[model samples]
Target: MIKPTERRVGYGVAMGYGVTDLFGGGAFAIIGTWLLFFYTTYCGLTVLEASSIFAIARVIDAILSPIMGYITDNFGNTWLGRKFGRRRFFLLLSSPLMFLYALLWLTDMNYWYYLGTYLSIELLSAMVLVPWETLAAEMTNRYEERSRLAGVRMIFSQLGGFLAVSVPGLIMQFTGKDNPFTYTLTGLIFSCVFCLAVFTTWRCTWEAKDVQPEHKFKAEVQRSSGLFNHLKYLILDLISSFRIRAFRLHIIIYIASFTAMDVFGAVFTYYVIYCLGKDAAAVSAWSSVGAFAAIPGTYAFMMLLNKLNLTPSSALRLAYSSIFFVLAFLFIVYYTKTPVPDMVFFGLFILNGVARAGLIYIPWNIYSFIPDIDEMVTQQRREGIFAGVMVLTRKSTVAIAILIIGMVLEEAGFVKGNGIQPESALYAIVTLMTLGTAVLLAISFYVTYPFKLTRETHKVLLKEIARRKLGGKAEDCDAPTRLVIKQLTGYEYDEVWGGEATRRVVGQVNCSRVE
Candidate 1:
């Protein structure tokens, strides 16, 4: 049974995670929605140049995420009789760095300075984000609870996106200006929000108890094994993660789904402003509705997951299919001159929001369960490897998707400041790409159905861990199973717990002839 204190700590940790996500997502949305326009129209860079810069930055960040993951997993500090751990340390340090770098947006830099500043800020953001994500998996071991945590974090993340998208419009409306100074003022406001997020995350949460002295000691011992050994271990873990058939399938599906989602998000504002000829106020109104809609949709999906006992694959398939069908219908309506009712459009927007909620929340929740399954197989909790590789995959997809979307726009004759193209063509390109990607995502989701580890299977694995002394005390049983219980059911073990029970729990058994 979990204690009240532990629950409180988890809640606090989740809140910190939410805030961090808010800061990151909000900042990115501001950049994605407006920065491109600023570059092409205001700063006078070609569309290709700006797109190339963004793509290269994302690719570099993708490469860096795994490296950061490795560093965090291996090198951590011991504090207050427990390991302060890599995740929290990096989070604390990077918060301020992220804030400082985000202020780069306010500068009036030429092309070279702009490119360099953007790349530098993006790299720093990834350093903060990669490890921050790993912390979420570390914080809990429960499946349903992980979903709840992810749901909460995602809601805040959307709120961040909402602010990022809506704030610029609000600022422009209030100040009665559309100049560079307006953008600078908006960046300053975002910087303040980033600082607030950092402080809350730093002070509000407790480090997980599992991050203790023994884990730190084990990590140290591994360090002495040399660099080649460490590389070998990483490679083996990567291979083993893929060998799990379900995990491999899940990775593929996640790549497809997330790539589509990221591409859509990056381009959605462009579509609204250029293709629909809508202003910031219209975009903000629709975006707010979409963001708020996700809250109820997320809770509904969670309830559906429980009631239906659906696997991640099943949930994803259902959600993706719904998104595709709705988008397709909307496209047809627009193309056929049927004049889709405003109410119908709003409903579709809500559907899109619901689809997005599931797409974002379920995959991470599923991944949180993978470490336990891996531990059951390898007899080691390699949470870092699992989190790292997943980060690598997701980031790589984002990079590739950005590149692809840029190329697609170039091919479709999308020129900066050309004004909206023929309505039919715009509809054809945007809707076909979005809906096509969704269809592929559905296929990938279906392909992953065979790999899912059901709740029953997970229970068996947990029992196996107990039997093999992977998680609990041999003295607690007389079945010769060699089970090692490191702490009481409701207590967390640390250096301060220096009693005989602790010793026995750590497998200090003596074998001598009976006298």
Candidate 2:
């Protein structure tokens, strides 16, 4: 096992760590953009049936994320955890399993077969993602280094997204666009890509030696031994993450922001094909060009957060505002039925790409620092639990939203693979693409008002945590630092850092007594 170092993270480490998002970003981009379309057109499924497959698989995967997180959190006590690594072990395990992704594109399968394949891939995704997401925190504590890692990761994510859209478009050009085999070939190619990316991440990343203390692990291992007790602790640990004020707010922001995008992605194809009267190839071409716009958008936001030190909330608000404009513009074009030129549509894709980049980038960048906030209240580095909770909320909510979108389209008399949709169906698609996204963005934008996290405040919070760790008296905390601590944790100074107030929280759980 390679020992983690305290040295600064360089470009090599950053690229290695970031590469796995090819799976993270690319796989999902393909699904969100085209999976339902493929299912309806090629697999002979209704809108409701297609969406049910996504919702069911994601809901199950969402439930499992935390369990996987807890296992990795304590896996260090096991031989595999000690030899391979708590987090990277799963990365190594999931690399080859990525081949299962190709099965999803197979045609003429029964509904159960489709459901089973989708569920398997979603579970595999949780296994790979739950642990991998924690590596950014486990790898480095520096805000700058963490930001660098996230920037590179999102860039690769965008690149994966780029390939996800572009490759399909190119493939379909050679092999007829309407052919089901086009999607099958796309899936097979990306499955190989997913396999390689996960393996690369396993090689490139290292977990911090001091992340989990010996005393804490011994206690945790003992507590989680029995089946019933493990279940109890898992539930408590997963729920405990929300107790941190920052984490709760972070989750609200994550769900509201991404769910908006999910709705847009789910409906955008139908809107393009039906509302705009364009072909599938046009959807792919415009989206692929937008993917190009995201690369620079990601880099610009990286500089905003790391160099200019923009507050995350401020950056998010800016991004959401841009997104809202794009949505409104699309609505107008559809509503007015103005015969817009190609350049105008292309311009909208460019703007959407830029806004979506910040939407994707800032929440995750903010997430890397969340455990630091959690550590203050719990005195434990429960990054896995935090990561688990984040994934759980994200997957569950996105699934539900997809389900609702599916239901709405079905209820509106949407027919599978129809070149022409009912007036009702077109109305539903346009409303979902515009009004649905606007509502989510509005909620997310409202939530960002009270969020006060920034680089300077985070630095202060970390310093106080260090002071508490060194056995400094809580009373010694200066006014400004104390306020920063209180604000971030949503607890008064005495109530945190092993204070009696936290005795009921997951951090202070006494597993021996629970039995």
Candidate 3:
């Protein structure tokens, strides 16, 4: 068992936390690699029909995400929850069910039946994912520790993604794309991997038994006299959360960029098959080998995090800029319809793999810090609400992306199961994979650029939160506290609002104005 240590975790414990990413990595990688292709080509559905089912399911899931978040946030505090652990119990319950995830790929039932299966899987994800995501916050409070955890998770995420891409490719190399057995065997393999990963995470990781002492007031605020009262409180709390400036910016950046990434995953098969005109083995090799780059890339990211001392937000922006150039070049290569040397093709993907490390890992690391910022402003760490909204944004945009991709595919004149696609259709696929990412990521960057929180800012926020929890007066506050106070209020008061300092210094000359 990984021993519990406060605010700092050993490698064994961090691995337990990150290993669960394998579930998402394997499950989604399979889905991302094959679902759209399976639904259209294998099942003989129209692109619109196939895409619409997933889109509508996501819309339903979007509505359910916040409710799941609320459930996850409070469930662990219950009598049964405290013993087994809220997040841990849900994960344990979901582990075996992960095996059933293969059933999604196994069927091509009537439309309603298919929809039901998809929705069922989506709901199951909400149950496990919302809770699982909150684990890091419970596991450790240190910023660097959280970053380390995200890095470890990325390594495994890339591993799962590699399985999704390469395993199928390897299978197809022998079995050929003409065989339906390829997808079935692929699903079975990936789903089993997914199941074991979630189970391992549940069995190995530790959850915090004692609540953070700073959260007492926030916990009290959670109590309600009736169902209606509780809901009213929930509504009010949700509304209040959106009012935070930093979070609002994160939402914009997160939704746009993440949607683009999701769409890229959805469309990659088409780019490989329709655009590149590669066989199955080649498709899988490029996808899987590219992901291997992410492992080394993750190693590089962690090194940079410690060595460069760049804040996660700053690092994300810088790394993303490099990706923009790479995407631009890839777009040019594909648009020209020129046959590039094999070496160049491999090299481009390798560079993309490096960039993927930052793209995939930085946002999550940044999210761990958001709770700290919320704690500073609200004096409550509401990670569940934030986690809920993060998934909500993602699910909602997924719905939009599927619909748009479906309609766009139809407009591009893509013919299902046709060995050769029209140039127009190929162009659209390449554009969606490259230029679309470039444009959307630029928008994501604009929103992220204004993000005000940094390690320095966060350290200040943590200090203030601890001091407030201890009932320390403003007069006893440190420089960072005084700086924050000056920004919120025009002048720093000598005394805190309810605390016992009589000398209310109205600051004839203030030094703490945030520069």
User: lDDT of each structure?
Assistant: 0.62, 0.87, 0.72
TM-scores for all predictions? 0.80, 0.96, 0.89
| Candidates 2 and 3 compared by lDDT, better number | 2
What would the per-residue lDDT of candidate 1 be over residues 299-363, giving only the tens digit for each residue? 77777666677766678777887778765764566456565556666777778878777877777
Residue-level error in angstroms, candidate 3, position 321: 2.2
Candidate 2 global CA lDDT score: 0.87
Candidate 3 lDDT over residue span 44-101, tens digit each: 6789888988899888887787777777667776987888886688888888887667
- In angstroms, the error of model 1 at 166 is 2.3
RMSD of 1: 7.7
RMSD of each: 7.7, 2.8, 5.8
Prediction 2 TM-score vs. true: 0.96
Residue 248 of model 3 has an lDDT of 75
Positional deviation of residue 457's Cα in model 2 after best superposition, in angstroms: 1.2
